[model samples]
Target chain A: MREVFGDFNDGRSAAAHQVAVRLDTNGLNITSEGAGVLQHWPYADLRAIDPPHADAPLRLTSRANPDARLRLGDPAFVEELRRKAPHLFLRGLAQPNVRRNAGIIILTLLVLGLALWQGVPRLSAPLARLIPMQWEQEFGLAFRDRLLAGARTCQSVAGTAALSQLSERLTASLARPPPLTVVVADRATVNAFALPGGHIVILQGLLDKAQSADEVAAVLAHEIGHVRHRHPTQMAIRVAGIGLFADLLTGDGSALAELAGQVGGMLLLLSYSREMERQADAYGRDLLQKAGLSTAALARFFAHLAAEAPTAGGGKLLGYLSSHPPLEERIAVADKDEAGEPALDAAAWQALQNICD
Target chain B: MRQLRVNLTLMDDDSTPSEASAPLRLEQRGRASELLPVVLLNTLLNIVTLSIYRFWGKTKIRQYLWRQTHFMAEPLEYTGTGGELFKGFLVVFFLILLPLAIVGNVANIYLDPENPASLFFPVILYMTIGFLIGFAIYRARRYRLSRTVWRGIRGGMRGSASQYALRSLLFWVSNAITLGWTYPWMQFTLFKRLMTETTFGNRSFQFDGSLKPLYGAFAKFWFGSLFGMLAVALLIWGITFADTAVSTRPDFPFSIAQIAFLLAPLILWIGMAWYKAREINLLASGTTFEGLSFRMDATAWNLVSLIFVNGLITILTLGFGRPFAQLRVFRYVCDRLSITGEVDVAAIQQSSTAVPSMGEGLADAFDLGAV
Candidate 1:
């Protein structure tokens, strides 16, 4: 290597001494003009501290005795040394090597696009189904208990009997009915939520707003449809999988479990996706039609909620609204659905309406 | 094309004429052309690997950053590898993520369901995590320092991570109890604690200076915040009075409370800016290593303007201007700060401590550890 100006540090303190560095058959040698002899480091023991930038301070240390440090003022000296011994430096993936870097870039983009669009969705679907029913039930029940712990459950005997009768009437037409347990919670929020494994919560405010039992049954049927489709599990799996994929790619593992926990608690609270909502509504319509109940009742309830939404106050109702995005197309389909007769008689409708009285 | 210049002054030393010695100057030599290519490649790799490329990608960035920083015309070096970072993250993920997830899910199931016990239990967990974060921050810094090499000698930190963490927690607790009035003392103590333990080669750093100089700025901020809060409370009371005595209309346009609410964030932002600038300046000036001291001539107003512009750019471009903003901030800091005094480098020998296998785990968890 050509002679170049350099600095030597003993690694003891920050004091730097100027020296001349050159490479020969005997390896790199250092000499101070006035001080005479400085140091002679063998090539085998010399370790190059690669600089990230193209032109940076050339720092090298002795592998055998790291306390010996050499800093070259000339980048050319580093270039010469690198040319002579490429094996001494660790390869950086981000270093600019046009042809190879280009290939990696192209491959990376394709994988990211594919994973986002198709791969993740395809993967999560089966994974969601694979989770055992026992786990899902425990998961669902645990979440539901925490969610409704503060709310009082209406246990009026007549109201309970009326609700059970209406549920029986509505579900009797199903091909294979799920084991449904419907509860009326004593909260004034105009909302209802369905949990995995056939648990449905209907708020008192929803019943108070309904003029007839058929209207309330229509809502329950929709929730039952959600259970039948196993939408909660699918939704939960999809969200968690996507998040984990992103985290793994970024090499961020620290917050993984914490995020998963947060997502779990919030899962039931998420209003079902639009497609799921529509499917649930369709299921309700078919079940109602089989029971000779009018689908117009479901359409009427949607319209009523939409009308009251603008006047609704507080963050509680906002949660309900966000989770249950309204679809006018579904409402129109609901209105056009034809059925033979009202399944609930006047007395049963009134009793169901007073279920939370 | 730009050329690399040695910038050698060639001035001679009279005391030791036999051995020529020169003064060293630090510089930032990063170029956009070099950085952009790496960034582009990394972005693509990040996309392809579904973010797995990021661990390596970050290494490349650090490599570029460290190389760009020159001390006495010699480029500082970064020897960290992408694979090492990836492995570190995975180890933490499997070891920490799984347990945390289980605990969190269980807590969410039992404690989140409206029970008073739920609230009380989660509070304990939060406090525990908060306390652990202190230790994690210290450990992360130690890791970073150990990884940083200059003139072949790596920088390092001493003292137990646990102790530092405990000290941080104590400060945090006191800050909470004292209505945040103990902030200056807390900041000063922590700065001294971390810096004094810092080492470049075998030599340790020294932190001097008192919070007595910062009290003036802090007091101004504290009083300003209090005034802002009182104004907000008064405005709320006035709005209620207006609603009752005057016209209780369906819509009350721009009441005193609404206006105060709008201004509260701005007030808080200003206070935070002032305190942050003063803290940074104090920290820089008070720190010394190998008989060399530092000075940061950055002012609060200058910082406020920098922050305002950075935020505006970020917002206007929808985050695309982030790199440019970051570059500008780096330049600003480098320009404003200068190291003074002398260092006895020839006397200092390489430290003989084994580097930690992995660190920055907590920083990764919190998403604040990257430097």
Candidate 2:
């Protein structure tokens, strides 16, 4: 009989016993000197505890004797067992369901990619529309307060009247305008942005830079367009959607999830959507035309901005134009030469310009 | 010479070994070559499955490492499955993390930043996360122990994870208030707590060590950090005022001091390695189970070289060589550790502590434990 020397742990104790194991067609015959077959482990009941390797032994246990372990150090025995019980070696990616597993994995990845690329944008607009306008306004006000915590709000009486007058002129053309509040912030940056809930902030430096009242009216019209379309609400929904998607992808709250959120936030902020910008520009132009104001001033303001500083769209100094549609594309939209009334009188314009003082 | 055959059921009747048995040393039987192929395959599968396969991959690696580790002439066994880990992660993701995320998002939108009352939200958030980390460490250790088997009897741990978390949180607060001077005491307390709860089958592990031995190494590390910070401040001062002060006198030794200041971190790291080696030795020597006590012979130079090489391997391979790095750590520990006295094999019965149905979800989420 062909026999192999091995060590056996009986599971009841931590002691190891040297034993001789003879392999037969039915099972393994474990025996010691002067002892007839102590136990028999059928080939069908045998399982490898560790995968077979070149250096280590093939550690096996029987289903019938769960805790008892037999380690065979002989290479020939492991090679022979491999031939008899091929099912033990089929593990990990080499299993019979490997193809199905791989297919399912690939399909899942494809679905996830598609959902992120198309589902978020498609779902966000309707989702944003479903939110109550009152709640959005409240949330937006709170957000604005948080964002502009230390900044001074510009509040000259005549300047406030002139600003609301210009905003009303643009909003009056709409069938149902949002509750717009056109406030001036006493900040030195040439920037203006519309917050969620109909809040438009025009900075003092923009008034200082504008040569005439028409330029200020043009900027106000642009902001009113953003509010009317509820672009900020849609943007918030999309950003939140991306964040949720990232959280799901990272399993639980991890550093990677936070990183993904930050990256997605930066990308959304830096780009701000060219298509959305175009919609706002087109709406602003239509508003200008309906209000009987000349679009020519907007083009002139952009031209002067381009000529004075070619680096306007690239730095923080020109925060108003940074990440805006290319100057030429915007200028082309507002380059019409229609004759119209000035946005405000000379007296109101001077008062508006000195609002920060 | 006649061989004696012992039946599996006969040893359950309490035939204990003598307390004065010879000392035994643990041996590592794994080869780096054997581990590499599995790790490489796992990395590829992780990419293919977007890391969803990592649970299985980690289980496979643990299985291999456990099977190759030898104690008292028999290899250890790991019986954990990938499905358990996956289910655990899913439960934590849906139950714990989702609600917290919703609360956080809502709080950010509504809470006024300038209000002192709103500070409660952030403090609560950090506290919850810190507590969860402590809870995860305990549960993770418990899970690993329950899966580790020797001669068919599994290891286990008893004690409340919540209690551990609360104690750890208290220690963290103490550490901050004391400017990290209480770190050695914190480590000793935590380790003692963990060891007191550890069990192998029916036998319990005990940690009997003093706090005085740890203070010497900790003092060296603490003073080294203080001096490193001082050097950094001096270097910054040199850069800011050197133009005016040193330019007037061309023969100043400020340049030499500048170089020394730049090299302070390297010196500190070397000193830290020495302290780490001493700490490990002390901790290992203090652990006892039944009649067996452990001793580890670790040196600062060997530890430093091992860390340097392991770091190099991990970085050079872009983390694919992590299994190899872990293999080196296991081999180093096994080679250095010596066990005195033998376990009374027959005296130990199978552990009856209920095993966790799932695995270490929070640990996976927090990226805790190397192997």
Candidate 3:
């Protein structure tokens, strides 16, 4: 009988027993040098949980008696067992590390492929939405800060009030409105974006080009649609999930915060998928219809954006439009026959236009 | 105008044989056939998992590399696990990273964007990251050392990571302030610190390299860099002269002057390789583990061709051939490094130093470990 050093596990929760372990033709038999009883583990009932690392300890538990275990102090005994009964010692469990057998490789590929392709895609959206509202709010505010950092804010009191009235009017009609903060930036980029939570940023250039309050309201409604559906939050979740996966892969913890902090920038830069854009558009139409508003205003804004898309020479404009391309298909969808009240009266429209004053 | 290749220590080995006829003997026992499947499987897994399998992938590679590389015909063993690494990463992500992100974002929201004070946020973030990276490298080195086992005796490293980080910070600051002149000093000291801290069972490694001999090489490269800049300027002038004047001549397409001018960058590359090779050689020669002398015989041309050819193949294959590249570098290092004197394995007992609970989390976070 070849002797090996190991720790024996009794049925009770006692201190580990230093024991002399021997593997015979019958099974792995253990004699406790300092403990109360001797145990015999048959090979059929013995199951080994191999150490994840090469130099770590190996644990063997009994299927016959769950509490029975033999913790190998030195894993060299395992190699000896593999040599003795090549079928019994299974840390190679099957093929050793990862390369000796083709079956193990195929199994691993199947499992990981399933986890990534189906798992990530099926889970990213719902998982993202599951994040608490408070976290999403904080996430949105941070992104907004990063976006408007070093840029001038539109601070005209009357124009601000006029803009607030329009936003409140549009959001109040919805069944559930996410907490929204709409601000006009004093930059000349014809764009508007919705951040996670309920933050929206509108460039002064968008305001400057608006022919009427309806056009501006159409743009605002579209942005509000994004917020209402928690698209930004979902987007943030996807990014965070990807960030988490990447960090896990690399074992880098610092990027956790960095990626979290970039949610706002990602929102600004990563264009929503075509399906998401369509969904947002559909949401916008319903919102406008419910608010006694017209889709014609949205169509007109798209028309103007389509025209400006040709002259997309401006650096900021390129950034804005590249992220939110004004598709001809989307413009056509907005050209619905539905009509209702004008977005604002003449004085309110004038005030809204001068919001960046 | 800057090219950044991953900078990593070329691993050295001590074979299992004691009696040596060559004073020092080095050998590589890794078969390309044995490693090819591992690399291919890892590559496949990475693609399927969107690279999430990389931790495990890297672990497998290390395990193979360690097992195949014999010192005196006895292969070293790597004791690290992918699970340990993954757990460490998850802990850092949850405990340190996520909370920090939330706080940072909230803080940025309150900061005045128009104020110059806000610029400090990014600078502070970058600096903090740098510091963390230094700390991470220290810890990762400790983990790697602690996991290295030869003939049942484990190699270990123990020192304060923050102290290492501080020393590294000082070196980096000095390097910056001196316009890169302090690099050799910084590298030597840093390497010395690492070696001095390293322990194998009961023995300790010593790095006795001085900064003086290294300066000649550093100065040579520094002055060579200046000359390279001047040559580049002249080359541009020549190119412009050729563009304007040489087009008129149909028969003189191949001029000796232009050909020599075009080779200036190659000359600079050669100088850079020479400087690097010299520093590495000096470092290897200066290091001793338990009274054993180390040998390194690498040349500028050897490194230049290896890196250049490896790079060309990697780029051409679009990274599919990375396993071969990795294998080639390992073969190169194994072939070039040798050790004198014999290790008494029977004298060294197994160290009871409990393995570190985690692996290279912060290093992974900082992206400090190239491999």
Candidate 4:
């Protein structure tokens, strides 16, 4: 008596064996012997066997008849096989094909390449649209006008003479005048921004926060570093790529807003690569020291900003912090070396603070 | 031995035709047993190659998992090789990553076109490509493992590449159409179809309709996201209210609201921990096969509590909470889970001794017990 279980493509050879016993992994297989003799037995018959085999016995294959097989005699083997077979089968099925795996890898790389190819052009389109060389001249003129207007505003806020005197001192200090103008904005946001073609905007709020003129100078010096490095142009180009990508994908003019939003988000979240930040910090510090301003004020300003009330909308504050090193860390680095005299006298500090009011 | 004569008598003339099927079964040990050595070897390789082995290590794990479970017959066999797959993936990935890297470098150079240092763009491009390709290979291998491991038994898993691609496309389309509500259903259907189609030896595969576990996983994920959002909102609200309340008095430098704001993240962390615990417990307990039943000995709540407590401690203690988490999960599976048959953890561990420590750590973390 033999049992065969499962679907075997090759089964005919098993029938040829005399006194053949076949065991199926799941059941039994039997054939008919005519003339009042029971031939084929079903899988259910195993249940009746004394100390019944829970699983079919292992089948040993014959070389001459590829399909012909015999069951192992040990009943224990059947029990153990039944106990573990499911897991074993699962494990076998789970194994990855080397060729298929390799194929998938290659396919994925191809997809990635395709995505980049598709994505980059979309990213670059806005930059291409904006960079016609004419925009530089237009940008420079617009920047000059804004700087002049800002200077007038500063004069109105601070006494004219004080403003004039400050400007004259700044101009005299520059041996090779940079191709840019700096004017203080009346706004109370503690921000400093650089315009294309060397125009720098310093907010009154930033000036009020600086305890000393050197801190104000530190801010200006950082802007100067940006102007010198052409950081604005680089930033514009980077943003333009993002904008282009958005515009291409959406095919909507409103995507310009999305682009701006993305750029703003990026500016807040992305720190200047460590080397870039270090270079800017070094340049600003060098500028302040040469101008006879103490660099310690920069460290003081960082500490002050860090201690400020965490901004409303955690997103904004998180955004700001993401792009900059931890304030305490930056402060520590600045305080490592103390050099030069305080750039602001008591009167100058008072005047700078009062500019916003 | 006595040759016992059994009566060979035909019961009746009406004999049912035997089903022509040859179902071959092979035992599969848990992934943890196989994963440990590969992980360890890769970690060691990583040290020797300055992180290059990180990519190779990832590929190796996928390959190892695939090989461990593969069976051509009753005695399982594996046809895939990690080295070959890794190399193939790397080559293809580099071809793609290199160009994008070039673009990044070119953009960097264009920031200052006249500088001679800009010529280093090609070198930067190549290095970036190499790194991305390595990472991509790792990702690819992982995907392959997850897909192959639960293959069904009938018709040997049918679906052409185009069909798969279409299915993936429809997955996204349906998600968009149904506003993400259909995601779980889609996932279930896809998984069931994939599992049922894969055939080996003779038996076909089938997934027991166990949507309860899946629903539990989804609920945990949803709750976790909700908690995280709530924490962020609370922080914002607290900060705003404090600013308003304190703005009138310049002398009031600090406010209670500020304290509330700071503690919001802690609350969010707890929520996340809870979610993770719930999710893991549901997934571990929910999975079952046809004609086979599985039961986790540990209560779901107990597992969840263990994870939450350990995770919180880890978070507060700068990542020292991992060992406790691992121990808890191990204890739960070893002492709690039972299949109707025998399981020997010690013996399984012994067989996996060739695996490295980090590999073992990962395997332990995932709780892939030996079969």
Candidate 5:
């Protein structure tokens, strides 16, 4: 019989007792120096509290006396224990259920990724449409008022008449024109925005940059296209949906979750907006042709922008041309001049130019 | 590693030399080299799994650290599993965060930012988050305690987590209202609450620490910070004056105020660390359990250096050397801490507190798990 010397704590005291352990078919026999046989721990009930490591002592605890502990540092004892009971060594990746767990985790990730990518955008558009038109209009009006609170708004009577004339002419051929609220603001940035619920903002800079009234009318037509498609409301819904889904999956508003939501939201919105811009361009051209305005005005304006600076209208959060499809591509489709009348009379055009004076 | 055996009465005499009844010491047997492979593997797995494997990775690390820590010549054991942590996360995600997020988003859509009434929902949201964070800290501590076992007897914490969270929220509000003067009292009260409820086996710990010992250090910290801010403001004013009055120090490329601005955070951190060391020492010396009284010998310089070096190691290695930094902390604490008084181990029985089925969900989400 091979006897192994070790330390035992019987759970009764803090004292450590030196004992001699002998391995047998039944179990381990522990004997104190003066005391006779102390306890018998069956092999089946034995468990290693600390996973066996080369540098760490093998600490053992048994089910019979759960509070009792045994520490065996001898290499031979470890070898004997391993040979007798190899099941105690299974840990971490070596566990039998590792493959099953990995499979479950992979499956979960795929489902989550697919849902975020395909589910959110598809759902948000329909959800946006479901919101009552009255509520949407109220929201858009409040949002627009707050947005333009600091900017000076130009309300010249002659300019207003000219603008109304141009707007009526552009929408005259539509089966049912939208309830548009157009405002010209005094700002030095060349941009126009189509806000939710048919709110259109024309910057003074855009009027200054346009070579003719036809160019200004072309931009207005594009914004009207956006209003027709209800793009602004859909975009707001998309942002909210992505945020909610990211919170659902990642939880905690953690950095990782926030990053995933932001990057995913930006990429999705960019592509969706690019597609919306293309649609608006096509719709705007059709509107111009139907209204007898020059269809090639918008293309010329885009070419002029491209020639001036590729990033002329770039600024944080409100970049007009940055997120749009390349100007060259847009210009390609609208560059051809079809024989058409002027969008406004010469006097009306001059009045419109001074709209933001 | 040397232990001195003496009668329990020896600790009563303050006049007697500390060497007469040497306190018990903790030992750290783990090495960074031993943990390097495991941490590296876990980090790699975390990236591959989109951090889904982090719960398991944390469990593995805790198991190793627990086993390496030796008290009374026996190693501690960790019984927590990764599945419990994952379940906890899923529960919090679905039941709490998801619903709150949806409501907040919906409210944002409907609410007008220009309207004063719209602030109500946002205020509610912030308050709820604050309360949840407090709740998370208490529960996380409870979970850790329940999983920590020594000599087959589990360490446990007793007390209602909700009450603790309420107290935490109250302290935060009080701190803000008092301009942070109530901070020392809050720390002492909270630490006392935590320590008094902590148990090793069936023997509950007692904390007699008061706010008195903390005020002296806190006063110095407060005054020092005030002066630092005043100095910074003066320097800024000087820089602004110099900018207006041209040709003053034109040879010098950078303003003195700019340099002070850059160094302010570092100096402030050092000062905070100094006060923190004092706080830790006072708190530790006030705790006792089963006739065992503890003491910590943490010094300002040691703590500051430890923090600086650990930060450097983690940052320079791109976080791959996190285990090494953790090891340094464990070693530092073990080397400085000591215990006195005789332990009646026979009296301590297995703890009866029920182990929490789930793990640190909110803590993980909040990134407050500093382990």
Candidate 6:
């Protein structure tokens, strides 16, 4: 029988250690002489040689400088060893052959394909439904309703037709009007929600806090961008589909309710895609310029909001700005524009700021 | 390959009697065997209750199996109250049954007339309505079950109820278009999505879509059925021919003919079973996990024989053979299919330690035990 041995550990050992060697022969009585001192070792005490075979019996002999002599009289041991040699060699060779990251890319592609197959067609109709032709009118009506409600609740209103007309003219000049309906809430929580179905609710506190009309318009335009893209609906569908898919695959519907409850909250904090935000910004600037308003007003407004609340806890409004470019970056973009015109004439600016009243 | 002969000689003098000592008894404990009885009993209880005790029985079965099969001795505790399941089932049942009953009643009253033209439309309408209701209930129950379990894990469920309803509708529509053959594949896809989304103690379960076993089973069923039909046909033909020949020629003895006729069926049946057993062995022989491996027992043929005999008896006795068939199949699968190699209670306990929560771990252990 052919026997091969390789050092299991790197050669740093100082002491001689007796190693257990196992040999299988076909009914062969094999005896060894001059193999150095023999030690009695139980089969169980033998160190596992990677893959252990139960049928193999191992024996321990001395590790000394000696010429070992082996006598094989019994034919059984020799035959058994010959028979098992091939399998042993194959196993030894297979130990080091490992595949790295072979499945990851394939699996990722498969998942992506499946997602698109399930999600794309379902997304089209809702996307189409989001864009509205009369966004300014809708926003006007919603704002008026909120103002009326605030008036009933003993909150002061600074309602003016000139402000609504200016907003209308500004939106009409845009390539694509923002779909969000503006609702001014009476509370001063400095929060706004781009709700599902083009409903944008802005707190009066936020309006009151704004130093310029451009700042308020910037916020409104961002929310309008969210509505136009139907982000909330998309997020809702994605979350629901993910939950359903998970349940179907694992047959474990374990945390589905928690997922459901988080959907609305997550939507409220929804981030629009970067492309959508960029498109909205470009559209808003173009609309302001066409309406004879200075593009720098948008920059000035952000500067005021940033300075007034240096450490604005953005958690509540993060979703509204999720898809938009960073505020500082957008402020820079607005500042680069040198349109020689006032953002709003004094009367329009005053009227716009008090429209929530 | 040369067959190897291993010689184990009993050496005397300066040695202990190793050969006389019972062959190294490898004690195996905490195996799935321990949990089998629990699962079987639970299944029996579930059957007895007409599935009313399904949730509780399943929970108990899972707990027992997990505890017994896992390396750890963790106990699984149910945090979910039975009331949730009860309420869920009630809602599901009413949702499905009420609409169907109302439609059936309406059809019986309005369209059951000697009016033949009204029959087609009402029947179709009733079926459509019934389908819708069944689909709704199924979705609702699914949602409820998922939500309830998720709540148990302290995670918020985030999905619209309407979306779930729509998904249910879409699933049915797709399934209907594909007929029922796509059912298994759809189920697999759906299951994969669901499990991937769920997390427990930060680790998520993954679905491995290995359909080899199912395909193997299907192949066996088809071949077995074909062989069985052929065998029965041959037996019938042989018996009739032999009887006719014996009657026609007095020189050809009746006893010989009768013996041949009887032997024909027996031989055919035995051959069929032998083929089945061999197929089962081919499919199951090398299943291994961790350090444990299994070999299909040859006794599967004997089980098949017993099942055939019982089935025959049942048919002969006009449907009275069901209990015997059930008992035999159960006993055979249990006794013949077993695992071997390095499967100890300690290993099971050790394997379970990595599970997140004790309860969930135990549940997993039970599932393993059942497997």
Choose the strongest candidate by TM-score: 5
Off by over 4 Å in 2: A1-5, A10-12, A17-46, A62-68, A96-111, A122-159, A173-176, A184-191, A202-222, A247-357, B1-23, B29-42, B113-116, B179-182, B215-275, B299-321
* lDDT value, residue B148 of candidate 6: 24
Ranking by lDDT: 5, 2, 1, 3, 4, 6
Q: For candidate 3, lDDT tens digit of each residue in A1-357?
A: 667666544533222345677888867777754442378777777665433344545566677765445667555667766564554444433645444333444554476446544665567568767877777777788778878888887868888888988888787776767688899898887889899878899999888888888778888888888887777777655565555444444342223333443563354325444346667777777778888888778777767665776556334545455555445556567665476788888888788778777
Query: Measured against the native two-chain assembly using Cα atoms, what DockQ does each of the candidate structures obtain, in the order listed?
Result: 0.21, 0.23, 0.11, 0.03, 0.17, 0.01
Tens digits of lDDT, candidate 5, A52-144 = 887667888788987678888888778888777675677876755566667766886797777667776677668777978878788888888
Per-candidate iRMSD: 8.1, 5.6, 19.4, 19.5, 8.3, 23.5
lDDT of each: 0.69, 0.78, 0.68, 0.46, 0.78, 0.43
| Candidate 1 whole-model C-alpha lDDT, 0 to 1 | 0.69
- Give the range where candidate 2 chain B is weakest over 10 consecutive residues by summed lDDT: B14-23
Model 4: per-residue Cα lDDT over A296-332, one tens digit each: 7777786776567545212445645554455555677
Evaluate model 5: give its TM-score. 0.80
Provide the lowest-lDDT 10-residue window in model 1 chain B: B10-19
Instruction: Report clash pairs, candidate 5.
Output: none
* Of 4 and 5, the candidate ranking higher by DockQ: 5
Expressed as tens digits, the lDDT of each residue in A1-357 for candidate 6 is: 433221111012111112222353322122212343233223222222212233322211112211111212233543444354433333422522211111322353366446645554366336446635354344335434554464322223433454355456667765666554455566766655565456666676676777766656656655665566665445544554544333222221213323433453344334324555676577667666666666676567666666777665233356254645566777679768765454456676665556555
Which parts of model 1 have CA positions greater than 4 angstroms off? A1-48, A51-83, A86-179, A183-193, A201-357, B1-26, B31-34, B112-116, B224-255, B262-268, B313-326
User: What C-alpha lDDT does candidate 2 achieve relative to the native structure?
Assistant: 0.78
Q: Docking category for candidate 6?
A: incorrect
Per-residue lDDT value at A226 in model 4: 67
* Fraction of native contacts under 8 Å reproduced by each candidate: 0.36, 0.26, 0.08, 0.00, 0.19, 0.00
**DockQ score for model 3:** 0.11
Grade the docking of candidate 1. Answer: incorrect
How many steric clashes between backbone atoms does each model show?
Answer: 20, 0, 11, 40, 0, 65
Fnat measured on candidate 1: 0.36
Q: TM-score for the second chain in candidate 6?
A: 0.40
Report the C-alpha lDDT of model 2 over A89-161, residue by residue, as the tens digit: 7766676445555665566568766776788767767887898888788888877777778888888888888
Q: Chain A alone, TM-score for each of the models?
A: 0.67, 0.78, 0.60, 0.51, 0.76, 0.51
